[model samples]
Structure formats: structure tokens, C-alpha cells
Target: MTNQDSKVLRRNLLAGSAAVLAAPAIVGTALAQDKVTWKVQSHWPKASGSFNDSLVALAKELDTRTGGRFKLETFGAGEIAKDREIYNIVRRGVVPMGTISPAYILGEAQAMGLFYGVPGTLRETWEMLQLTKNLGIEKLVNDELAPKGVVMKAEKAYPTEVVLRRKIASAADLGSLKIRSAGTMLEYLAAAGASPQQIAGPEIYQAISTGVVDGAHWGAAIGALSMKFWEVARFHMKPALGITNDAWIMNKAALDKLPADLKLQFLSLLEERYFLRSVEYLQQEAIALNTGKAKMNVEVVRWPDDVLKKFAEASTGILKKEEAKGEISAKGTKALIKLMTDLGYV
Candidate 1:
């Protein structure tokens, strides 16, 4: 072989290697250009609490992690659809994703009440997470929810307290007052003689102020302060109504359209958000309670021991009624009861 032949062979080998290395970059750039953007609506209005802030942060993190190939546009309650309508809207693909409390949809599926944290069960976030993760409650819920065309990605549990326009020293007092509430909590309140009405979060202040309802079993301390619940309701009832779970769900069809890598990225971000935000919720709750009492003049009232016992009894009855509805409700109720029993709550 001549020197010219050797030099040509070396040049060809180098060119082939460069082409192989460039393939991935070329493909990646093309994929990047085909970016996806999804709209995510939350049940809570924008800036309603730290939880809402966390949603915004999740969107920004997803964008960064996906190299800007995937983006999320988030809207708070009433921005795109009413809070109760979000589940159907997401399922219909009107918007690709949304956050909601399963309890809000209990009318559609009685079993969904189990996912929202039973009125007298799952006292803490970790306990609820354990029931959902270790005890297979999460799988049960996803299996049920998937058939409806919406997929549950993550669940968030946060504590809530009751706010009242009129002071109540005992559970019996609740019966004399009309209260705004929903789900099993409403049922329990009714058993105690309270006239329980369903009211939207945005409407609670007006309802209480204008004598539409005497009080509300509303959101966490921070959320009530955000909505100025204290302006109408001066008393903040403690021993939290139970930590309820809010679901972050996506349109199954829309999620299926995501590339494999993007889907993994989205799920990973959700897990991160769940753990971090859980901690942030407690911190913000403390701040809200302190600020509400000091600056807002919102007084904390502890329910009497007898009243709590009565509430617990009523809660058990409501769970039994829900369990009797159907097989799905029964299965969910059994799982919850087992957890509560194990934790000595039952």
C-alpha cells in the first residue's frame, strides 16, 4: 500500500466516527423542537397557600429537567374551570391535568371518599402515605380512577380546621348552627345535629358573613387566612378535622402521548414534589396559625373531649354507611379501617 492510500483510509475512519457521535445530538434536537406543553389546573386558587406555590415550583422544575422540551402551564381554581368540574374536564382532555380532592368527587364514586382520608382516620401525613404506599391503597385508587380516563399521579395530605362565626363550646352546639362542609365530615356533622351545607371555598367567607351558613370546615390555617376567613369567622376550631388527600391527576390519553423519557421525568418530579411539599405544608401551617391568631385575631378553640368522642362515633357510622354502598366502597373502607385499627384510631 502507498502513503496516499494509508492517509485516505485514516480520513475515512475519522469521518465515520464523527457521524456516529453526531447522531444522538441530531435526534435530540429534533425531539426538543417537538416540545409538549400541558395545562394543569388546581382546586385551590393561585397563591392560595404554600401548596399552590409548590405547584408553580413543580412546573418550573419540570421545564428545567426536561431541557425545556416539556412545559406545564398551571391555573388555580376558577381560572379554567370550577374546582368540582376539573376531574371531568381533565378526563375529557379539555385540559391535560389538574389537582383535586377525591372527596369532591364522592358523588360520582362513593369509594373515592376513602382516598380523601376518613373523617376520624389517618391522623398524620406519614400514616396516610403508609396506607396508600405500603398497604396498596394507592393501587386500589388508581385502578378505580383509571377507568374514568384520569390517572392519579400523586396524593397530598394536609390538615384542616373548622372556622366559625359563632362560638361553639361543645359538639352539641354544632347541631344548633348551620355549617358549610362536605363528604364524610358533613355526614358526621349532620349526625351531631348541624345543618351541613356544601359551599365552595371562594364562597365560604360571604356565606358566613351574610348568615348564609354559621361556619365552615375549611382548609388549613394558611389557606383560611389567604381567603380572609377570619374576617367572617373569628374562631378557629382545633384537633384538625383529619388530614385529607388531594390528588394530582392527568388525562390518561394525554399522558400516554408523552415520550417514554418525558413520562419518567414527569413521574419523578411528582414524587419529589410530594415529599418536599409535605414538609413545607407543616411549616406553613405553623406560620399561618401563629399569624392568624396574632394579626388576624382568629382565636383557636379546642373541642371538648366529649365532643371529640361524639365526632369519632359519628365518623365510624358514616364510614359504615359508605362501606355498604358497593363492593368498591366496601374494599376501600375495609382497607382504611384496617389501617385505623392498626394505628389504634378505631
Candidate 2:
């Protein structure tokens, strides 16, 4: 009875254990082989600026990191949905992800306007970065956006400047100008006596050329140059309107469905690229400014101190108006004001 039966029993147990251990590896391999391609719709065109360029680079990096198991196809503004519709498109899963300016969706959530770097608020890139990273603004923003079925994976910011076809040196000059802008800045500009219109990216060039609008607020120096804004507008206003920040968001359901390891890899890669691209943009802005002035012959105009003061006052008034509309807006605006005040920005 004894030795032969005992040896056979031991061999059978070991074989079963080996098969159990090997099963998971086989399953993992199969899962990895099942590829996924997500479409990312962006509010910026492919050649618009560094932000869009970074997005393109990220898509390629995603393919490399996942060994081509995961891929991202990015579409520029107006290709899938207009800039203002990106948020809803991602929410409805028409696309898995999008690059959106929270300000564009102010109608959906009044608080979102506060998240896009309140006009006349933090002008420095470092300050804006700190607000999103260290001041908890990112959490407040995500808290509001998540309920709408989108999750912000990363934040991208760039310096902003106003481009004008006609010369404007002071607040008084604004009264005669009609400008195109977005977010709360429109309110601020209107308060300063300019007629503000919300124009989509593709229309700005024609708007400036055909005399539909005298000027427009756009991304930093690099952004303007990339879009060839100088061709239509000769003046670039200095002391940027604000450091504009937008969220790179994903469909909550689609993101949650990713395998745990792939999810981690995706987020990690996005974060690293976001940081590197932000730094690159800062450098590019400087180069663009110099190039715009020297090579492109674009005029740089600085608003008078009194005029700038009025803009700050207008921004504050608009912020208070928005804060009064809803609890979320109130909380978000209060937090940002407190942060800026504490940091000596106000």
C-alpha cells in the first residue's frame, strides 16, 4: 500500500499547484493581447501650440509604454465637436477623452469658470501651477467635474496674451474696440467697455481679418505665433491676461474599465509628460516673444498701470457675481481668492 501511493499522491499535488500558478500568467497574457484604442478629442488644433503638441506626443508615448496594446487617436478642434462641446462629448462616451477648458462649460457649472485661472488673478506660470498642484484647486475642480461623468487626469497651463489688429494703449482705447474672448474674461473685458464675443478657434483668424472683431485673447506668445495670429493682428498685449489652465479629462466609465496595471501606467505617463511639456512651453513662450518682436515684427503693447488696475477690479467684480450664483462657485472662488491673498498675489 505505502510508498508508491504516497509518492503518486505527492506528485499529483505538486502538478496541481504548478497549474494553478501558471493559469494567471496565461490569463494575463491574453488580456494584454486584447488591444484598446481610445480617441482623444482636443479643443486645440494639431498645430495650434505646445499643449496640443504635448497631447500628440502623449498618444505616441501611450503606444510605446503599453507595447502597442493601448493607443490614442487625437482629433483637433471642430473635427469631432466644437471647442465648447468637448466636455459633453467625453461625458456621453462619444469619445473616451478630451482636452477642455473648464471655462467653456460655465453654463453647465458656474464653478468651472473659477478653475480656469480667474482673469487678472495669478499671472505667473509658477503661481498657476502651485494653485492646481498644491492649493487643492485641482481637487475642487475634479469634485465638480466627476459628478458630470468626467475625470481630470492632468492640468495644462500656458501664458495668455491679447492680440489686436488695432492699437490700444489704455483702458480708454478699449471702449472703441470689440474683442473676442472666453470664460470670465469676457465679463471683465465687457466691464472695461469692450464688446466681448465668444468665438471658436477656427473663426478667430477670419474674425480678425474681416473686421468682425478688432482683437482676441489667445494663448501665450508661442500659441499666437503657432496659430499665425500675427499675420492678422499686429499688436500683442503684454503682462498676459492670465496663465490659462485647462484640464485633460477622460470618460469616467472608460477610465475605470482599464486594467489596474494599465491604469497606473497611463496616469503615470500622463503626469510625467504633463510636467515636461509645461516646462518646455515656458521656454518656448520666451523664445516666441523674442521672435515675435524681432523676426515677425509684431508690436508688444503694455497697458498703463491705471488701466491694468481697472481690469483687476473688473475681474474681482465678475468673480463675486459668479460666486453668488451657486454654492460650488462660491466655495471654489473663495478658495482661490484665499490662496491668492495668502500668497500675496492679490
Candidate 3:
């Protein structure tokens, strides 16, 4: 075929694929005979509580809903891919799919920080849901990731909380202690005057248990309870940080192999899981906090009004700084500012 003809055919193929993906997902149960099972590497460790269970639930539900024809076999953190490297692994087809935090890849894709979590700029789960679903955070992330040959469909968003070895009265106290953190929270912590270190998920427990770091912020109460961060750090801070550090990413080539009908069904499952997981984790956070207080002897510390004021000032500054990162980051920052204004936060 001529070069023009080849270009036309490729455009047609791409358009056809887009149509299939854009179709309103059919919510009914229908199975195909493809018999495809993709090995999925999880960013969460098997020992992690609901984090791992949530993945297990997805695998089982996918199997049952697809009549056992489409499924996922999950491997925990570092089993095949480290938490930070899951995106690269999934893109390279080392595994067809994996969980990754956009925060993990910001060194190269700073635009994704909008999806991972923007500390201080957003507050409350409802605010985040609004930003993601209505303010274009989700679509923006999907669009930016397309050129990189990876597709993100779901999320594992929860709070980025801190548990310190000792309590402090204000944000100024943060400067005296070293903390284990990651993503935008680490940036926020550092800007707020705390010494923050980016450590992998699995190593956080040991890091806190020993004197490597004074304390850490993983995922609020649930994340702390997952690895029992309470045992090492006796003080848990209240009013946890923003909910983020999550994206369910997959290899485009592997996703394209599925028949159109199954593809829609699979995407629907992910959307459903996102909604369910949001509620599940929120509930789990409350329960985990209770468990820490009653059974584990963890003291919950509520920062003073002045300390909250300090954090807000620092967080707003960081959000403004994010706008300088890139085009998508700026767009996200703009959307968040509008949302914050609408909510009377600014």
C-alpha cells in the first residue's frame, strides 16, 4: 500500500478502538471464550491488610463475573515488581497490569502529580471525588498517560497520614524530626519544615521500627494498621493528609488483545471497584483508628489551631509551586483552585 493509504488505515484502526473504549459500559453479566488470565503485580504487599485483600477481591470478582474466562493472578510488592517500578514493568509487559501511584513516577511525569494527590490544595474525600470525576483530573491523567503506552483505569486512593514518635504542638515542631514519606506529601512535609525521606512501602515498617526514621505517613490509619506502624510510632496525628497515591495501570498491548465485549465489561468492573473501594477504605480508616486507640495504645494527636494554620500556608504554597511543573500539572492546579474556591477553602 502507498504511504497515504497506510496512514489512512492506521487512523481507521485507531478510531475503531477508541469507539469500543468509549462505549457506555454494559453493566450486565456476559462472558466470552477468550480464556485470558493476566498476571498482575500489586504495589501493595501480601501482608498488607485491606490493600492486598482489595486486589484479591478484584481478581475473584473478575473471574466470577466473566464466567472464569477473564481473570487476574496477583503478586505482592517486590514479588515481581517493586512498588515504584510497577508502572515500568506493566508498560514493558513484564506483567500485563499493576497498581502504581502517579507520585512514584513524578521524576519523569510531573504532570501526574495532579492524579496522585496534591497536598494542602485538596481536603476531604468529597473534594477529591469532585476534582477527579468532575474537574477533569481523571480524564487529564488518562490523556497524559496515553502517549506513554500505558492506560490507567482505577485507583487505590487513601489518606497520606503521619505517625510521629513524639507529639508536637505546631508545624514548627516538624523541623526537629525526620520522617519517612513519599509523593507530594513528602514535598509538603519538607516545605512545612519536617525532614522527609522517600522510602519504599515495604521498608517503612522496618525504617520506623529502627531509628532510621522517627515516624512515617503511609495511608492514614488503614496503612498504619496494615504494617502496624503503631507499634513503632506511638503517636498518630489526626486530620490526616490528602487521599492519593494510586492508579490502576495496564499495558496497552495487553488491553487491546481482549474482545470488545469483554473489554467493556472489564473496564466497568474497574469503575465499580473504584467507587466501592472509596467507601471501603474510608470506613476502614475509621475502624483502624479505633483499633489503634483501644487495642494498640496509640495516642491520637490533634494539632493546635496555629499548627493547622501553618500547614495550610505551606500547602497552598506547594500547590502554587506545582503549577510550574508542566502543562498538565498547571491545568490540574487550575482546576483544583477553582474547586477550592467553590468550596470556600481559598
State which candidate has the highest TM-score.
2
Write candidate 2's Cα lDDT for 168-243 as tens digits: 7677888888888988878778877788999998788789889999988778787678888888887988788777
Per-model TM-score versus the true fold: 0.88, 0.91, 0.87
User: Better model by lDDT, 1 or 3?
Assistant: 3
lDDT per residue as tens, model 3, 263-299: 8888998888877887788888899999999998999
After best superposition, candidate 3 residue 260: deviation in angstroms?
A: 1.5
**Candidate 2 Cα errors over 4 Å, as ranges:** 1-17
lDDT of each: 0.79, 0.80, 0.80
Q: Count of backbone clashes for each model?
A: 1, 0, 0
Q: Over the stretch 1-346, how does candidate 1's per-residue lDDT look in tens digits?
A: 9999999999999999999999999998787567899998888766467435667878888999988989989887788886679988998999999888777877656566777777766788877777666766666777777788878755466786788887887767877898888777787677667798998766777898999998886567877888777888888887887877777879999998898789988998887777777777788889988998899888899877777887788887778887998887788778888878888875
Clashes by residue pair, model 2: none
Error of 1 at 346 (Å): 3.2
